[model samples]
Target: MKRFLVAGALASTLLLAGCASGTGGLTTGSVDSISAVEPGMDSGMVTAEGLKTNADGSVASDASGSVSTDVSRSVIKTASVSVAVDHPLEVAPELATIAANAGGYVQDSSNSPASEYQSESIYVTLRIPADKFDAATAEVLALGTFVSSSQSESDVTLQVTDVDARIASLTTSVDRLTALMANATNTADLLAAESALAQRQAELDSLVSQRDYLSNQVDLATLSVSVIATTDAAPTSQSFWDGLSQGWSALVNAGSVFVVALGFLLPWLAILAVIAFAALVIIWLSIRASRRRHESSTPEE
Candidate 1:
């Protein structure tokens, strides 16, 4: 009986040890799987079971360690241009039309009237589709004399891939938690699974929002345009007739200004004349008074 009891105790210990070792192995595998889904990991060091080369030579994967064949790149494009035009108001509508024809829309626009020092100008912000960015920019450049232009492109491929990986990982977690909740046999286990699910879902929602914002940026290109109305008309070599016409117009303008200025001074001129006359009258009266005094002093002369 003692031997039997000892044998039973030894078998129980071995069984418990085996079960613990299996559970530990499973835990380690789970951790490695999660790490494999993270981006920027060295493929040589990490297992490539879940990742596959896409058509564009990029790596893509999904939940459940499955690789996808579809591949795409994300880039954010932006441009700024300064142009000189004869009429900013006229150019503003032309720019709007150009954007529309290129499958773009005006995001914002402002027209400033001419000031003392600055000429009339129009500023336009446009959102064009990625495919139409270059063509639209070319058309906009054609609208007026190009003063300056600059374009920039930013690669967001790695950022997008990272976000996708995180989203996949979170989705897997949510799935696992759902399974846990379904299999829960007690109230405490059920409550724990539900709480974990809620947390993961919230995180997933946030990541989704971020991904959407990035996607929009990739899809649309931004272009800012400044159209300044030229203060002076461009200098051109002119024929004698044209020069003569311009000279006449200038002369007429100068004469009109002179006449207007003379009109403005007329009131002051009248006031000055009235004061001069009053001064002469006073001088004459003083001279007469002096003569009377001289005669009175001379007595009987």
Candidate 2:
């Protein structure tokens, strides 16, 4: 527990505080350029018709009107929570509700039977909004004793920016390809332009889908919560032999006490010993006299 506290303190001091930093956003590429590529020129043009690549090094008079934009990266927010509750079955749902009320949802749950010396344990993963993560954790701790907990935040800002930039660049490529395909007089040129346009369009679609996924991750922070409940087990009763063993143990203990008392009464022990010896001697003499009298009478008869 002390180790956990120390780690937590260090993390708090060293880790970044905010979900975002410096208007923290995805990294993005700058617009490279927008230039007209003539039929004989080796340049690229993004236009409304289709993607256009020049055969040679010349600029088309109409290519000057188009502009270029770069895609940016996406940033994601993440965290985790783990705790052992005294009553998992009873407390887990309640805790889940608390988390829900705090703008979180249970992601998953696990359960196991009671072990030889422990109660049933249940674990649940709770995902909450980034802003409510702290409150959610506190409410869970209130459900029962806290065994352990931890939290972390990762910077996906650069990744997000990169995906966005890719999407923008692809979208621009698709537009240019479409423009060139429309203007092509040769079937070969038209086919090549259409193929390029399709490729760029597909890439754009993929990037946009990636962007949406990243957006969701950033919007919702994920936390994993685990709960364990203490359960009552059947008590084991002592058997007949067990009772006998206990009785013997008590007798042995009493004998030890008696020996100890004798040690403390050494003077009294000597007096008791002398008295017992005198009593035995008196009984012996009386028996001997009786026997002698009976024998004397028999001889006279």
Candidate 3:
């Protein structure tokens, strides 16, 4: 009787120990199954038996920990680009629309006045979806000639990781408070638990919102494009009445030139006039001398 009692006591102790050790929640009755689970896994309402591995090395039930991800994200990213092109107003909006289709927006836009002989110019700033930045930039380049372009990138990986860690801590605190609420024996305790839970939840919400905002900033790129177009001079034609008036004015100018040419020969005309005067004087003196000599010769006869 004593031996049987001892044996029964040992059996009960072993069963109780196994339950306390949580062996029921393991695969093949092994406690190492807990080690297989990863942190941040949402394992709610799943049975131990359901977690057993199959012959194919796959879990019999869905386990988020079964897969691991290496894709990490940055909290903030800042990039700036400057480009020069032709026809900014026309090309800028088109580029802005393309950015929008790719999940971007136009922040600002401006255009310079067209010169009397040249085309207009445009300047613009655009926000683009992170994934479509490269493609959209290539399309903008196709709009006109490239004068200058520069790109820069910044990473906030550490900040993002820190925020995620805070979120996790807040979540754990909330979980603990939730578990405490199930066993609250007094009104004061229950209120305290609820208040802590609310605070943690609010903190978590803020962290999530900030992280999302920062992630978006990093994911998208901004491009500032300036456009300049070459302008050609246009020719103008004159009317028939204008042409006739110009020709008549030219004829009048020719007559004035002929009058100037004749005035330049006035010295030669003056010399000829002086010689004619001298010859007339000589003839008059000879006529007087002949008359006087004839009178004197007739008297002598």
Q: lDDT values of the candidates?
A: 0.70, 0.58, 0.59
Per-prediction TM-score, please? 0.56, 0.49, 0.45
TM-score for predicted model 2 compared with the true structure: 0.49
Tens-digit per-residue lDDT, 1-301, candidate 3 = 6445434443332332222113332112311222222245432221222233443555444355553333354523334444444445567668677778888888788887777545677777777877778788877777765555777765665556546554654565556567666756667666766765665566567778877877777777777776766332121566898789879989998898898887987888898899999999999999999999998888553
Ordered from best to worst lDDT, the candidate numbers read 1, 3, 2
Q: Indicate whether candidate 1 or candidate 3 has the larger TM-score.
A: 1
Q: What is the C-alpha RMSD of each candidate to the true structure, in Å?
A: 12.7, 23.3, 25.8
| Candidate 2: segments with Cα more than 4 A from true spot | 1-77, 115-118, 230-301
What candidate 3 gets wrong by more than 4 Å, as runs, is 1-79, 83-86, 100-123, 228-301
Clashing residue pairs in candidate 1 (N, C-alpha, C atoms within 3 angstroms)? none
What's the alpha carbon RMSD for model 3?
Answer: 25.8
Candidate 2: deviation at residue 287, Å?
65
Tell me the tens digit of each residue's lDDT in model 2 across 1-301: 6445433433332121111111223322212222222233233332222233243523344446553333223334455454555556777668678767987678788877677556787777777776777777778777765566676666665556546545654555555566565556667666656665565566566668878877778767776666666323222577899789879999998998899898989989899999999999999999999999999889654
For candidate 1, give the lDDT.
0.70
Give the range where candidate 2 is weakest over 10 consecutive residues by summed lDDT: 13-22
How far off is residue 98 in model 2, in Å? 2.7
